[model samples]
Target chain A: MIGYLDFVIALALAGAMAVMLTRLCLGPSLYDRILAVNSFGTKTVLFLSVFAIMVGRADGVDIALLYALINFIATIAILKFFRYRSLDVALSQMTKRIDQVEGGQ
Target chain B: MANLDLTQYLDYALIAMLVVVGIAIIRMKNLFAIVMLTGTYSLLSAAWFVSLDAVDVAFTEAAVGAGISTVLMLGAMLLTARDCKPEGKARHIVALLVVVITGAALLYALGDMPIYGDPNSPVNAYVGMDYVAMTPNDINVPNIVTAVLASYRGFDTLGETFVVFTAGLGVALLLGLGGRKEEEN
Candidate 1:
């Protein structure tokens, strides 16, 4: 049942996806960008699933599931990185103080 | 494509919602607002899939788009800065140019595509139909989505999972612990 309506829907999703792109450009925090990217991933899963339907296949659902799993893992990794980065920054500041005291001697 | 009298009406509504929700997600300044909108966008998209008569696809979209993506977004937020850095003029110019070019390119590509659900398109006549028709017999999963994901496309899914795992591991390894204190350094 291909129709003009489906095309409009697809394009609209594409437009919505474009909004996510805006977040990549204007996201207030780095985390926001990551969230936006994850949103994009979910949209992609939806898009592929729709395309699968468009092609009359059951395979798109399968891909979407895989994508969901992937998106979660990615978020986990990014958080992990952020946690470490902050700790490192703290350590560096302390080291600088120690070095200054020692160098004065 | 299967013969739903209400499908057209639903499809149009769904697409409209998708566009509106997407705009809201992008324009809202609050991080939480964006997250909620994104979820809504996914849910709306899943509903759109259902209207397309791809029940399996619809189910998958509902699960991943509605459920899992939000959880990930929340997790990432804990460590990330609360707000984005203000944009510079140079960056804004670059972003506008990129969006305009990419949008133009995509619109051009759309013209060559087959009409939505055209049976003669290679997508319909290709191996996808074979998977849908025969997957039930070989894999016996009533959910063709599952059958293809776990069976025919199992290997690819595995690779994708590995990528996710790697992303997590990298974040943990690189961002989690890589920042050494001065003492450690």
Candidate 2:
């Protein structure tokens, strides 16, 4: 049955999450931790989608979509902040580059 | 074992994971690793919320907890030390005692709550039933959580939106990201 399949999927996802949790907790380097967190976010999105189907709520997909977008943006923001030490600096540099390109065009 | 359902097993597993992650976060010395574990904790808790059929709460947790909060914490960490300073043993003991007492109090309080997802629970008996029944006719939305959040509780949702906006504005102002100034020569 469909319910059984959903249960199996949920179990598998939970197992993967457990592995990611170990990596997150035991990371010797910052980038390793970041990669683990990123992978966990992707797994969470899939888990949410499976759960929505299991619960017979098609609209749960909306939440999953929101998570997908926010997760991507957050990862980028974190990486930029880590590299530049200031989001403001990153933003201004990006804008200045864009303006230069536009002016050249 | 025969009576236990899939959801029950899943809930137990997720709760166990959450507890382990919480402990790891507390014991971590590296601030960056702690932040990463916190994000994982949030994701696990969000999954637990979904299992409880609280999609709206799960959505908010996923977005705010795992998403925005992680990024903000990383930014803050970048601005500060990557490793946490060692604390005195006395301080550690005091903190542990405080945590234990607070956790014990919370566990005691949990005894007064109704069983999860019980149809006969007071919350489900009153406003929840009405929302479920009226949502189709009142809002015509397929998702009751959406209808309740956006329509039935429009003013509350608006307030939440404004709170988020204000937080963003505060961060932007604090970071001086508003207007571009010439780099110091």
lDDT of each: 0.61, 0.75
Tens digits of lDDT, candidate 2, B1-185 = 32137777789889999999999988888787787788788878888887787777776677678776876787688578878888789998999899999999999999999996688999999999999999999999887877999998999989778756754653453345554666652
Candidate 2 residue pairs in backbone clash: none
Docking quality tier of model 2: acceptable
Best candidate, TM-score: 2
**Against the hidden reference, what TM-scores do the models get?**
0.50, 0.83
Query: Which portions of model 2 miss their true places by more than 4 Å?
Result: A91-105, B1-4, B136-140, B166-181
Model 1 root-mean-square deviation = 11.1
Candidate 2's DockQ is: 0.38
TM-score for the B chain of model 1: 0.69
Looking only at chain B, model 2 earns a TM-score of: 0.80
**lDDT of predicted model 1:** 0.61
TM-score of 2: 0.83
